[model samples]
Target chain A: MKTRKKVKQITADGFKYAFLTIMLVFAAFPLIQVVINSFKTDADVKTMPIGLPEKWVFNNYRDAWEIGGYARAYFNSFLVGGCTIVIVLTVVGLGAYALSKLHFKMRGFFTAYFFVAISLPGFLYIVPDYFFMNKIGILDTRMSLVIVYTAMQIPFNMLLLRTFLGGIPRELEEAAKIDGCNELNSLLKITVPIAKPIFLTVALLVFVNVWNEYLWSNTFIITDELKTVATRFVKFTGEYSSNMARIYTASVISILPVVLLYFIFSNKFIEGMTSGSVKG
Target chain B: MNNNLGQTALFAIMRNKKVINNMKKTSIIPYLFILPAFIIHFCIVTLPSLSTLAMSLFEWNGIGNATFIGFGNFTEIFTEDNVVKIAIINNLKWLAIFITVPIIMGFIVAIIVSRIIKGQMFFRVVYFIPYVISAAVAGKIFTAYMNPYYGINVFLDKIGLTSLGDTLWLGNPKIALYSVAFVDNWHWWGFVMVLFLGALQQVDPVLYEAARVDGANRIRELLHVSIPGIKPTIAFVLIMTVMWSFLTFDYVYVMTNGGPANSTEILATWIYKNAFAKYRAGYANALCVLQSGICLVFYFVQRYISKKGGMEDED
Candidate 1:
């Protein structure tokens, strides 16, 4: 009986491992294939899609960089994403802190505002938003993208930061008051330092979302030189289709930085996102 | 002198009564802090929304003044457009797959990942990496990969499995929608896994140990403890996926561009083309309003179900 059970258990474990390994391969296959394909000349990719190239070629990257204008696109993405993070964090952090920690008569009203904003679908406003941006004379500029992204991000991030703030003990603030710290001083000197982990998570999350955004980038940033990586990449593929070599190269370059950032920050990003949902 | 000073102090206090009227005045400070978010939300989110709603009452090209059309645009959308019908049907299909597949895959992956002690973080991050890539990039990559000439299609063709590459995956009207959903599953399953993983970590280990000592085995332990552990998270994820599936635009727009007889048209993309491309701003807004209403109804229904479940669990 013991021998039979041992054999069964071993077989089951083997099956489980096999299943896991298969799934992992499937999950990783596209990334691997793309990375490999990006290095191949167009003729090689067409001939042998699944296998390694006969020789490693570096010319694709050079041609793609020059033709795709990825350097300028990267700069634009950074400008848009960076400005969005800074503006959003400042506004939403202050707004979230006040909403969570302050005692005010209109707190209910502001809370309702956040809820309604969250519920409003992005499509509902895109047409009007385009018109409004035009009226304001900044329709195609990176500033428009920054402001719009910041606006949508604020409600979600504020709600997240509010939950984090609410978890911190009120006694800390009272203690700070006894030590002659005003509200702003207490928030800056004490709360901000302790909330660094959550803040970083929020900042990174916002940055990634802004960077990965496509629709708004497409609609808002029309100037070719000013387009972000996401929107520019689509146009690059379309314009450079005959030069399939360069499109693959551009695709690889576009994803590399973001992928690296994600791998590095996945831990905090996952925690921050899940915690926001649970606690808030 | 005492009477004069006392009377002046009483008057001063009385004059500031409006400011001191509220007992929870300190609570007002939170609202003050929340004001900046509100202002920006107004300008960026709310104001545009109202204008969109107003525009739905008019017929106009973006360049010219919008002509007052009232419900004409809405009528035209529901009555005239075959593509809108296709879009709604495709959206329903998306909603169904969106809810079922991710939650199932996420749960299964979470279960597997939980049992593995080594390389858990590495596996988790690798799964989620795709989620961070923009839909445009993913669309491009997948379009190439699924291309009949050079993509996964040709690989299948080479191994006497040309039947698998028989259909134009994105170009075939019958199978195009499913192709989009399949790609979406790839982009999304990892995210759902993260939610499950978070819930899984919070599960009490003692329960599992107890199950083991009782000879409950792996399957039994998963059925009893793991399922219950992540029940709420699953529900939340399901609701969120439903919402997102309805709002899906970027993927469909980039991948199929609603091609091959509009097989892959979904609500968000349809609305986008109508308002922006077709220059029917009013009709598009009407579609948006309808979509929002459906979404709101689902949101509340999910909330109610979760609340009731919470009560049951508490009991």
Candidate 2:
């Protein structure tokens, strides 16, 4: 009986390792391949797509940067992403404070409001908002995206931020209240400091989202200069369709910033992504 | 004594007015705090969505006058739109794929990773790497990687899978959507696994030990112990999967763009085409209403089921 059990254990371990190995390669192999192909010349890429380059020709990235207009893309991405994070954090911070701490009529109603907001699909407003933005004459501008992105994220961010704010003991804020601080003052002085971690989490998640978001921005932002990496990428591939290497290089360029951030903040990314999947 | 009584009544009236003024001042503070977010959210998300009902009742090219044609757009979509039928079917396919494949994969991986005592984080972090890549980047990479002449086909041919290797991945009408979904699932399931792992850890090991003592095999442990333990999470995952299945746009849009004769066109992308490309905002709104109705109904039904099954508490 012991021998049979031991045999079963060994087989399970073997299966576990085998499955994990397959997944590891399956998840990461294409990413590694893209990076590998980014360095190869066009001929080399087609001939040996997933293998090492015969010579590490670094010009593809340089060419892609110029051809893809990556400098403008990067600047636009940061501008949009930074503004979105600031706006969402500030607006949702105050709103979450009210929901979590302040006494108000329709408190239950407001809670239910955001709860429903969480379930509403982007398809609901996405196209309509384009016409709305067009009517307002902000259609091609980066500001349009900033506002739309902020609105879309507000409910989910509100949900997470309110949960965090609620978890902070009421005593902490009451201490500020006893200090003769006004409500706004108490929020800024006491709650913001204690809730810094959650704010950071929200910011990180928002940054990634704005950086990665394609559909709305693709429709709204018409100008080349205003397009972010996510939007520029489709155009880049089309324009540079003849040169596979440059497109491959552009793809890597698009991915690296997020990958670098993930490498630095993997734990936080995981935490934010899993916890902030309320919207998803 | 009459003068004293008059003065006391005046004092009480003055105090009452002061109290009312003070109450008004403090009560507006919470609304003031929330007003900015509320205005932005309402104008951008809620207002547009609400007006969609009215929009669906009208016939309008986006920038023109909308004439009221009650139920015209709705009738047209149901009776006239072939692409929508395809989109609805694709969205259902997406729902079916998501609920089964990723949930099972995530659950199985989480169980195995939990069992492994060493190097668990390494396995998790690696699996999650693909998820961080944007849909555009993934689509671009996968397109080249799945290229029949030079990509993974080359690798597969060497491994003796000639038939599978030679097929057009995103070009074929039949398999295009599924191919796009495969990339999405790659980017998706790891995050699902992490959620499942989080849920699994919250399940106590004592139950597993008891199951083992009762002479349960590994399959029995999975079915009896683990599945029951993670029932709430499973329900949550299912609900999200069904909702998101309808929401899927990025992958198909990036990869195939509902191409090879609109084989991969889901509702969201079709809505985009109608509103933006066709200039038929009213028709798009109708589609939006249809998509929301499906998701909303499913969400309620799933919640109802979960409640009946005692899988989750009512919020």
Highest lDDT scorer = 2
Per-residue lDDT over B1-315 for candidate 2, one digit per residue giving the tens place of the 0 to 100 score: 999999999987975675456446678888888988889999999998998877989998889899999999989998988999999999999998998888789888999998887788898888888777788778877877766677777777778988987889988898988898999999999988988898888888899999999999989998898878888778888899878888888888888888889899999889888988999999899899999999888888888888897778556
**How accurate locally is residue B191 in candidate 2, as Cα lDDT from 0 to 100?**
84
Runs of candidate 2 exceeding 4 Å displacement: A1-11, A276-280, B1-25, B157-160, B213-215, B304-310, B313-315
Expressed as tens digits, the lDDT of each residue in A37-152 for candidate 2 is 88999888877676789999989988999989999999999999999999999999999999998777877888889988887788888767888889989999999999999998
> Which candidate number maximizes TM-score?
2
Worst 10 residues of 1 chain B by lDDT: B18-27
Model 2's chain A TM-score stands at 0.95
Q: How high is the TM-score of chain B in model 2?
A: 0.86
Report the error of model 2 at residue B41, Å: 0.5
DockQ of 1: 0.53
Candidates' DockQ values? Answer: 0.53, 0.62
Cα lDDT of all candidates, in order?
0.79, 0.86
In model 2, the clashing pairs are none
> Residue A106 of model 1: what lDDT?
75
